[model samples]
Target: MKYRFVIILLSILILSSCEFSQKRYKPDWDKWKNYKWILNKNVRNNINSGFTLYKKNANFNLIRYNENNQLVIWEFKHHNYVSIDSINFFENIDLSNFILYPGQTFNKEDILETSVRINSDLDIDLHLNLNSDSKIYEYINKDKVKGIIGKVSQMSLSDETGYHQVLFDFPIRSYNVATLFFKRDDSFFILILFPDDGLVKDKLKDLNLPELNE
Candidate 1:
């Protein structure tokens, strides 16, 4: 009886520790506002998705252009890195070698490399998933060899600078997507590009952006 009681207490303690650790690593969104934003001209022109990327150390601030040509800003803080090689078809090729062509037909393998990283650890992914269908799973099936296929209507690329940026139009009806591939770091940073619809556009009205005079 004493041993059972002791075991229960130990289990509770372990659970508590895990909970605390998760909370500790949870991103502090409030503090993210304080990071300085430096304009990245290379990203602005090369991948002309109407969004400009600003660097803040390992983090980035994205200024997205809505359908109306208005700008909305979003900040992305890197939480953790997931290797692209872990995904099936991507295992043999480096992500940088892949070029995205707009209006091109791509199978599950093409989107998998980017979608997995987006879905794996970000709250933004959850928000998108709730609003749209499970497009990610739509591509996966019994034959790991044969995957789902879809078309990419909007896409952009930039390789001039050291960092490679590729923007893939999200399968979701209303969202845009941009991903940064860093050669030196061997990692990718995903940025959610909120569509310039009335719902999201109104909320970003108060965001202070850098001067466009330059």
Candidate 2:
């Protein structure tokens, strides 16, 4: 009977150790610092989908719900290369040019109808503008380009609710220049569009975001 009790206690210790190790392996964002919240009328009007931008080191990150209604995040790094130029470039561009047909898969030709380029050397210009390292230039240059169709979906976060026009993919270079427009009541906003580069996959796992309802 004593040997049976000892075996059960050993099993309990093994399970507890496994659980502790799993928890320890998880990434913790709360420990990270230097993230600052910033407001940009342009971002508010165009790309953020009415959400605020978070600047971390030199990278800019935004979080929002995608067409699938899943929480997705977009990140733009190496900002010193593109920030001002991107802002000025997008200011003159009209978003009305790009509209997605519902229930259809969009292509590069469909995107061209809206005046946004799938790939532009102008993006490469950001790297040149900053006189970035060759490796950095190559990284941006080699990033694959893809299109994200713009569509509006109603979403609520905390107490605020609005209809957000989801658009484009990121690294900012891929979409050339795109925008996300949001309307909440009588107010309208725009943000400079970038491609959805999926840089937030691991970060999202770290955040432990709750499963959202459709």
Candidate 3:
């Protein structure tokens, strides 16, 4: 009976450790090879439905969703990149003539979408729920991107309550971005878009684009 008690204690300790480890906020930054094209499984059931994001007619031509946990890093150019998955979400992006160009890389600058497991260890929930406006602005300001005040709106996606924002200027302010966050069970997915080289900084202000919610 004494031996059985010891074994039970050890099992409890192991389970507690596993739970703590899974809840930690250690983000995986490196590993670009895990990024995958949406043509395979990310697409909708219809053959006519192309491999674009939840929106339509945006300058964000080339799009790719990351299959792994790490955030997709833009290899070159001045496209905006989000480091923290919790703060950056997706919404309104403009369509462009951008496509697989001769010189530009394919997967790097395209649409980056990834789902992160929601847990208390990352403090993502705290920042998102408690004073999210201040936290988001603080992070974006730290990136040296000025006048980027994102107003998050709640939207429904297939029976799920998702967060939406248009022209989310983060990590990079030069590019107009659309990001969306949807909670599926215990995890939330973020979809971010970057315009092609043809859409320059000078033209962004002039274009009157529609929000993804429309």
Model 3: lDDT equals 0.28
Q: What is the C-alpha RMSD of each candidate to the true structure, in Å?
A: 15.1, 19.7, 16.3
Best by lDDT: 1
lDDT of 2: 0.26
Q: For model 1, what is the C-alpha lDDT against the true structure?
A: 0.30
Ranking by lDDT: 1, 3, 2
Q: After superposition, how far is residue 22 of candidate 3 from its true place, in Å?
A: 4.3
Candidate 1's C-alpha runs over 4 A off are 2-7, 10-16, 19-24, 27-30, 33-173, 179-188, 197-214
TM-score (C-alpha, index-matched) for candidate 1: 0.29
Candidate 2 runs further than 4 Å off? 1-28, 31-36, 39-60, 64-79, 86-122, 126-214
Candidate 2 per-residue lDDT over residues 64-109, each given as its tens digit:
3332112223333332333222221111222333333321111224
Tell me the RMSD of model 1 versus the true structure. Answer: 15.1
Clashes of each: 0, 14, 11
TM-scores for the candidates: 0.29, 0.19, 0.25
lDDT tens digits by residue: candidate 1, 168-198: 3334343322122211233234333233443
